[model samples]
Target: MVFLIQKSQNKDSKAIHLKLSEIIASHQGTSNRMVNIEDLTELELDQLRKFYVQLSKLAAKEDA
Candidate 1:
């Protein structure tokens, strides 16, 4: 299934979001932000998840 995450809120987040978008687009061959969960291998998904977690933590730090 395709997952469409919400847009991020600041410059750092926007950058991270753009990077992730690019990664998804590159992997999925589409311009849309939607990522196909089933298309990704386990390792790729784990790395993506880790990047997402890091981005969240970084955003939280910016808020503090």
Candidate 2:
């Protein structure tokens, strides 16, 4: 149903937002390269997917 689809998308967005926050937190004082959203290319994005998976696994483990 449309509601389910909307809920799924919302969940995904929240996951992405949480993962992004963690990623930023992890690099808070490091010299790690940070890019602006407008500067991201497709390849940079593909690489960033790894962080999301890692963050989600971490979150799942914490919940369990």
| Per-residue C-alpha lDDT of model 1 across residues 1-64, encoded as one tens digit per residue | 1232332133335455545655643644655443444444546555766776787788689999
Candidate 2 deviant stretches above 4 angstroms? 28-64
Error of 1 at 6 (Å): 28
Off by over 4 Å in 1: 1-33
Candidate that scores best on TM-score: 1
lDDT of 2 by residue, 1-64 (tens): 9998886676565545545655655754532344343245545554666666687688789999
Cα deviation at 26, candidate 1, in Å, is 17
Query: What lDDT does candidate 1 reach at residue 62?
Result: 92
Clashes of 2: 0
Q: How does candidate 2 score on lDDT? A: 0.58
Clashing pairs in 1: none
Tell me the number of clashing residue pairs for each predicted model. Answer: 0, 0
Candidate with best lDDT: 2
